[model samples]
Target: MTVVTQEAGAPFGAAPPSGDAAIRTRGLTKRFRGGQVAVDTLDLSVPRGSVFGFLGPNGSGKTTTIRMLLGLVTPTAGDYSVLGLPQARALPKVGAVVEGPAFYPYLSGSANLARFDAADPTAPRGTAARRVADALDRVGLSAAAGKRYRNYSLGMRQRLAIAAALLGPRELLVLDEPTNGLDPQGTREVRALVKEIAAEGTTVFVSSHLLAEVEQMCTHAAIMRTGRLVAQGTIASLSAGLAARIRVETPDAAGAARVLAGLGLPDVRAGEREVTAELGGHAPEEVNAALVGEGVAVRGLAVVRPSLEDVFVGLTGEGFDVDG
Candidate 1:
């Protein structure tokens, strides 16, 4: 890990609007004892009003980077800024829930938020309360606001934690595995809320291992492997460079095989009811042309696009079905 001087002073009174990039970091890294590198040299840019997803396998250092961003753990190297101010300089403007968003189980959701509001000297009580209500409504938890956190379900508690993060009306919200314990419906709710928040001009930084979820929600994403970033971009841009495969089915398997062979493509594998082939710049037209070329009857043709899960495994050299 490389050493650098920490930025001096905090931006407490009012944060300067430093343009639209909500989060930016250069060569951010962290190392613990025994030569363990939790976060390798990392650079990330999260634009304002974008819901950015940081995705990776378990132990990929998403938590470590978030902790560093929050000033809970100092980076061994590099510098970062949040909401247009240097991270070390804008500690007051960053709101985050790292790891499971722990809260005192004894406190009610409203009470917990009230305590946090009181603790923030910069946040007025009325403003905080209004923000809290907005947040709870955003996460679809206004009905559960008065329930004790201990009595709340895991999903409810997670929503409450998100509501807490919004209490100060933070410009940037960083969440680490926010949907870890959520059910399918709860996950959908949180995902929708995240998009809504970003739509309202707040920058959202979410870290999750769920590739499908991220693909559905985030406008831009970065993939990490072994604490190092391996891929970063809009999903469409990243996927555009990947090879396209076709999953074709036909009424006549033998006829399909013959047609595919006639196409003269190098890679072609025939299976029961389907044939997979490398589509080199060939659109659905080529598939039809091939079938017509061979007089084969084609029943169905489905283009196979690489999912984020496929891309993740391809980049990391790791399988996706890990127990963790």
Candidate 2:
């Protein structure tokens, strides 16, 4: 992955905002009352038009960071930009659902959206009806447009929240825990909706604790631990950073281990009928040839790349809540 650094005369390794980045932060931080640091020095680079997943366990400061980014909360230190512009200048083009969705319990979905659109000074009053309808259709909630907010299902409620964000044209969508507290079907519904939105060229910044959500929906991801970012990159690049392992099943496990060690493979371990070692900068075919040439009968050989869970755990020294 490319490492972006702050401008000259700033912190040595801080990340500066780039023109192509949808969202960028350099040393962004947040500290609450009574000396609680909710967010540490954070440098984030979210490329434009990419579905970026902000991942971490609960209370890792994901929401606080999002609040600071949206200018809802002031950061104690550092600077950030949205859509290449300062927060206040860019919020008109950005839509967000932070924390959770809230609507008048007695109001219908369409009514609630109409009220929201009317409240936006930039939204044209004459286009209110059309925009409300379009936003409902975009989130697949047109069927439930007239349903009361209190009568809507959990999934419908979440979709309504997303619809509210889409009441006007948005270049970026920031969703915090969009799939939180949802069942399997609800989770899938929200996941598909997010992809559909991204497909239309909107930059999506999703804050989620569910690993499965990030793995399936996001093209790029940034992981946090204890209020600090640990890793950030495309999913493939993050996974590639971990070494792939070569596994060989053979009756002569000891001989296979010896051959693999002789070939300079690290972590060579011989089990009852298998030998495994990290395939660092070495081809699997080369390892296989060396094993066969050394009189080791290789029954099976396979290269296993590390999973996303492995990569995150390795970086943060903590496992994620992958219930989804």
Candidate 3:
């Protein structure tokens, strides 16, 4: 890890924005004592105000990267700049919920938030209550502010951790598997909260294993495999090059396959009632017309677009662990 110098580091009170990338890393790497390469030489660029999904299967170094971004763990090599300046200097502008934030179980939500907010000495001396109240409200926990932390459900606890991150103005919010262990309803709630946070113009960086959720919620994404960055781009851009497939079901499936094969279609497969082939930029209209011209009546037809999960599997060769 490159040593952070006095000139490059600043306190939480550093001046307003200085860069375009909310987070940028060059050759960021980490390795434990046992020689486990959790993260390899990575170059990541998170655009400002984007709901960026950091995706990977479990143990793909998502958490380690977040830890390094939040300064919870130091990298064994490389360097990164957050919010346009050296990370140490730009932390106040960044908020994060890394792993499960440990809250005092005996304390009420409001009380716990007050304590956490108080630790940020840069914050004003007199507005603790208001800040805590606003933070809890932001995460939709206003009604449960007075409830003891121990009594909260897993979802509620997760939101509280996010509330804690919102104690003050934040330009960037990094969440690592924000919905890791929640039920479907809880997952929906957290995902909704994430959208709201992004709507407020904050750059939300979410590291999750839920491909569908990421596909639905994130504006941009970066996919990881093993310990390296595999793919990164706007969801549309990343998927734009993925070929679609055409599937048609008909009584004359075998004939249809023969026709498609004669027409130079590749990977044509004929089953009981369906003939499918890799579209490879071939138009569905072209396939449909050809089938009809060949006297094959199309019963059902579809052009299947590849999903994020498809992209993930293709890129990483692993099934996304939604629970991860």
Candidates arranged by TM-score, highest first: 3, 2, 1
- Scored against the true structure, residue 282 in model 1 reaches a CA lDDT of 75
RMSD of 2: 4.5
Model 2 ranges off by over 4 Å: 1-17, 318-324
lDDT score at residue 59, model 3, on the 0-100 scale: 88
Whole-model lDDT per candidate: 0.75, 0.83, 0.81
Shift of residue 134 alpha carbon in model 3, Å: 1.2
Question: On residues 111-227, what C-alpha lDDT tens digit does candidate 3 reach at each position?
Answer: 999888877767775888898999898778999999999999888888899888888888899888888767898788888988887999999999988999999999888888777
**Predicted candidate 2 versus true structure: per-residue lDDT over 198-256, tens digit per residue:** 99999999998787778899999888777777778788877776778999999999899
lDDT of 1 by residue, 1-324 (tens): 111112222111122244656877778899988889998878776667777889887898889988888878889998877776755546556667789867777887777888877876677766776877777787778898888788988888888888888777567889889898999998888888788778777778999989899899887777787788766767775565456777678767767777766676436778887887767667778878778677777778877887777776766654442211
- Find the number of clashing residue pairs for candidate 3: 0
Clashing pairs in 2: 6-14
Candidate 1, TM-score vs. the true structure? 0.85
Best by lDDT: 2
Q: Pull out the clashing pairs in model 1.
A: none
